[model samples]
Target: MNTTTLASTTRLNPVSRPLPVLLAMEDDAEDVGRLSPDDRLTCHVHGRWIHQCVASPLHVNPITRHRWCRSCATALTVSVDELSGAVTMSCPRCGHGASAASARLIVACRASLVAARRGSGARAA
Candidate 1:
């Protein structure tokens, strides 16, 4: 997507910004991997409250593993840099940082997950 289109598709609605940097510092980079079942919930959390993307309602958050949106599946792949411990959500279809909003979303979602797991009480199952 072009910058304008991407901007419209993904706005700057970052609910959690600084937390991602903190997570990068605290967690090992190798700890992050392909999205797992828990990571599915992370996407859900981001879709509903953070990004408000329309495609989110159609997403399937199954218990068996992590899921990606059609767009995310097609254009992006999320990974963690082992040396820095930073969760890097990159778009293979595009170039590095091609999707800044997506990168921010990943960071925000991961941060929120860490907070929720650490007793932030943002949501509960």
Candidate 2:
């Protein structure tokens, strides 16, 4: 998308100004692979909540094992509570998907949940 499209979408209401960092991330250098999942949650991209997109194939990392279950050879399942904003990442096969990356992601997801619910200025398009 061009600058024009991005400019239009970041507008939450007529009187509001766009936040410096919460704008669209579609042009974010292709999926923001290097960006932390938590930071990805704070930005408006894909028009979905953090929990909605956290389990995407893009998040799977076999080498670093960010969300990988080495023994099961599968990506971990993500569960998030909407009201309570609880995030869970467990292997679907053996329930052994725990890692430093997943822990960081969980924290980010919870914070994102809070922001999504409380911040009127950071709505996704």
TM-score per prediction, in order, is 0.31, 0.62
Q: Model-by-model lDDT, in order?
A: 0.35, 0.60
Residue 31 error for model 1, in Å? 33
Candidate 1 lDDT, 1-125, residue by residue in tens: 12222112122332232334423322332144323222221333342322223134333332211222344444344554333435544445544434434544555555444443433332332
Q: For candidate 2, lDDT tens digit of each residue in 12-73?
A: 23233233344355236225443433344543444565566777877778777767888888
List of clashing residue pairs for candidate 2: none
Model 1: lDDT of residue 31: 41
